[model samples]
Target: CNPIAEGILMAHQVDWLRIQAQIKLCEKGRRTGITFAEALDSVITASSQKSAGGMDCFYIGDTKEKGLEFIGYCAKFSRVMAEAQASGVSEIEEFLFEDQDESGNTRHINAYRIRYASGFKIVALSSNPANIRGLQGKVIIDEAAFHRNVSAVLDAATALLIWGGRIVIISTHNGKSNPFNQMANDIRDERYGDSAEVYKATFDDAVANGLYERVCYMAGEVPTADGKEAWYKKIRNAYGPRKSQMREELDAIPRDGNGVCIPGVWVDEAMRPGREVLRLALDADFVHQALYRREAYVNDWIDRELAPVMAELDPELRHFLGMDYARHRDFSIICPMSVDMSRHRDVPFVMEMHKVPTRQQQQILFYILRGLPRFVGAALDATGSGETLAEDTADEFGHNRIHQVKISRAWYGAWMPKFVQLYEDGAITMPKDDNLHQDVRAIETVEGVPMIVKARSQDLKDPDLYRHGDFAGAGALANFATLEVTSGPVAAKSRRPRQGRRITQGYA
Candidate 1:
């Protein structure tokens, strides 16, 4: 229904609405020489149509000429913004340009900070500025909540903008507690009465009041539905009225900023013979590479402090390594971990297990290839540049099982659940080795899901019900039977599984 309107808007040639403002300013000025303040009021009044939505979309224009007129008006207003500077405590204008190109190239843009009387300047931003100065001008930060350093936005703006008496922060957000929404709410509650003119409104608020509806209607910009009705009438009846999800998002944040991701609700990783692996996870950051390194929680701590009293399986099984790759030589890493294990010490023993240089990638891979003589698949973690490297290595060594690794996706769908169940069921055991323990601790769960890999028989469980460790070579031997040659981006292997065949055997 909205396709045609979107198509038209996409092809809109001008900013017509602005042209009207220009004419109004000219006529008003002819009668009474318009002051910058008067011009500011007129511009705000003209632009404040709730119907036009946040940014201009539709207006008085039949052919593309009207669009061009709108563009001219917008440009003119921009010029006014570019000119109008320090007014008696009220900032007249400002503009910010920040975004990526169509091809995903990042662009650095300068902020235009203009004061009517005091000139303007552009400086490189180490961090986004919410306020360049106090009485002169301010800025509206784009994505306030998702920013890693949201505090930076507040510190800059509140220091300058609030003292100046004017501010208009704007954004379309997910919900409350989103830094912007929270700030807006705080302002709404008179928390910042001394600061600025804080008004929080969405595009919908403008549309409902007929302030911007004409433009919105013309452009087909309307609120989206929550989802389709349920298949059963009962389900539909149970479902409540449709609402924007912003409210729901507000409910999840920790009010107390102690860094506890989730409070009170603890995960239950109790003993269950057939479902032991509680969570299988992986993470790239080396700082917290060991899952036990630290978080405000208790997964690894339990394995150390309580695994003995829980499932008591620490040896007798086979352990092998699971590796996800990277493209560049710098990022490519190999972490050697043990399957059928439940402690950090065991992980450190499986040879070299640190994040090493790129030069060692092929050599370590060579050692792995030699150990697991049979064709063992590895995720060639490379997008474009890495792909070349992976292909070259595979060709040079005649190793063709180089699967393009999408580490996150595979773990989410395939590995996590299995890992959790294995932990819960006592399907894994660890040896008395540091490397193995560290690697196991390194395993991070994606969305609370575990990345379960294959293990071999003869797995051992401690009598104390604490640790579990399996022999390393045994795991590779078991997994070795399941592999088949599947080259880059192709379907999983061929007709018959190439069980028990060396990777170099296919040299023909």
Candidate 2:
């Protein structure tokens, strides 16, 4: 190896990254020299003969400028190691390539290419380019977490693996929910069956690997241990109070963004592991049938399923319920929250059901309200298909006891902060469920307002669980209910009379 190339590989992080793996993924700190080291590896691969396992390399970045910068590293590696190579790196060239949009519309792109003395070459590509699907070669996706469609890019990259081409994915996390972070985690957990190699390098890891000393060296100053420590401290201090940013960018910790409605740390802290929790699972068909003939099946369900669970709750504590209604596609999350006002702890009990009829949901909610020792207030989602059920619940419970919440940008903008404050102040506790954790993380800030992602999907085998942020929405509603009942509890209203308002509506 050339001295420059050898020096580049001398970094411990670089050495870890250089291990020969067909599928390589790196969760790295920002501004570390991992990408630079990757460029040297690309040079070595592209400059070697086919008999030596060399292949044409494709470098994809989040932007064309990043492509240029990566190619610049390759150019430097070529210059410093030309005599050592059997097939030397040649001059960089600019060319136009025809690229296509997602809609099959064609456009020309200015791409940078570097040809080695061997038949192999390296090309730099912009993010999410459709033309990548048409290419067959070793793929290097840089800053994958920041790509517009990282999942789609990964799909394209994996296609090349069938032909024995390699794939290298590297980026710091953008959010906890980003596909790149999830894939890296899956690989680390051995979900991919040990074919892939995983590399994790945080800011601290790079610093221990001589990152600060290298910075001093790059600045043309003699590197010292004390000077390196000072530089590291100064860099970390620049991100004060924005701990999520620091964690995501430097610590290699997964963070959705600053606008996430709830901090993942808070959720983790609030989890009551191994605690007894109730989950009532009901299918759509059974719920629908039970609703029409409530005396036959629905009543039995409440007694058999809901009653035992209700009995387990703390009888003395005041309870409030939040219901986000969805009949199909998304789960209807009903969160029953108990507040020990004296202790100032809000313990939320999670109940998620999907594809259940609105009538069964109403019956379930009615039973929950009737069984509670002290029912403060309930907030029911009244958006779109939820309107009828919400209104029915409100009519049954009265305006004093039930709030028919129609969610909007203004609604989330005003109330989400309070919900988040409950988490930040350590006033909330939830059950230990990974799906619920993901729901909390799915809430992102868009244009200074907090909202759940519209197109977000959870990777669950259950199609009903493929919701954006059902639990988060219900959690927010539950928090909102606490604000509605300030002084004391109000009795639920009824249609006929307090006595006649049980399950029978006297309907034909």
Candidate 3:
């Protein structure tokens, strides 16, 4: 439906707009503070841009494809437009525009010539002014969505357009690179005399309204009723087998396509009844996801690393306690552990994971938890390595006969799994919450591998994490847990420094 030639024509029209009298809305006053006649005077003129040297411009961009294109295309197009504008002007005017010409022309304009003709300025650039600081026009990036990264580039281009009439960008979008596609669509939407107020319309409607493609389909003709299918066949006929590539591009980006994603749980529902126990799983280094909530990419731990606990009013179990006994920044964090008489060998699963960054990281968790919800009891490392930074949160928070005891550092590969599957196949159902059920997937394993996982951190004394759609700690309210499985006395190497006569160590 889109045509590159149309881009060419639209680019040309934009160039023409620069020269149009009506479009010349230069609110900026004369830089020389002199009248036109005085500006021509050699003594009165502050400086002659006619020499075309020592000018300043800046551009900024993100890492997205569309952002990348904006900088590249705009830089390319500006020069191309300059050449097109030069067509009608005489050689005398060209020579007058500069002063160092082999042909004795004053308008030689060589400062940007070789670099511009060679088609790259970033390579030619070195050194830095305070504002540009050698990093001016360089891409600046942040996180966004799959295609939101496209907008970052657009933002950068916008900054470039602003500073030197350039752009700047902030972005995110590792999963779906739709932002750039939208950006390209935005450019196409504004093409062919559309200007700023390009009315929203489909490709057929755009062509019908003489938006861009005018000749091939003739103005006012409707696009094929079959939509993309018809467009594909026609492109195939016109561009031969290579048209498949074009059609794939069209398929890759369905303009105005509906995105189908379930909304994630708000932070509070994540703390309600049965949901709790957050896990941090790693897809890659510097790119981990947390399953602390019922949603994929979700988190609900009030404190960063400490897992939550549920205390029931049972008599025999009241004495047992979940003691996470030790910690530091380098090793696995030591979260506030929980214990009760019932949960030993009773946890449905124990999972090990790495945490990612921000609430935005919840996006990935929503995907996994939306379908799997069988997991229970995730003991966490509350030590601030990847969790929050709170001093003795469990101590200040342990009102329900609970405490944030440090787990004496031991081999994780062996002990954690035993703890993880403590209650596997045991009859444990999370207390019901509408939001939790909706966000967590209810699917059991087909090949005998259960998918749902949960951890605890949801009773009281939490940051607003529980209210913020993180439900990993919801299970802490069910007191049928057993945190004190092997607690005669933990005899592992002291994970913490034993300074002054350390006799009673690991006894939180």
Best by TM-score: 2
**Against the true structure, whose lDDT is highest?**
2
| Per-residue alpha-carbon lDDT of candidate 3 for residues 264-307, written as tens digits (9 for 90 to 100) | 21112222354344444333333332233223223233122322
Model 2 scores worst on lDDT over the 10 consecutive residues at 493-502
User: At residue 458, what lDDT does model 3 achieve?
Assistant: 27
Q: Where does model 1 exceed 4 Å of error?
A: 1-74, 78-136, 146-148, 161-165, 194-198, 211-213, 216-508
RMSD in order of candidates: 22.3, 20.4, 22.5
Quote the lDDT for 16 in model 3: 25
User: Local error of candidate 2 at 502, Å?
Assistant: 77
Q: RMSD in Å for candidate 2, one decimal?
A: 20.4
Model 1 score (lDDT)? 0.31
Using lDDT as the measure, name the better of candidate 1 and candidate 3. Answer: 1
The clash number for model 2 is 4
Query: How many clashes show up per model?
Result: 92, 4, 100
- Candidate structures ordered by TM-score, highest first: 2, 1, 3
By lDDT, the candidates rank as 2, 1, 3
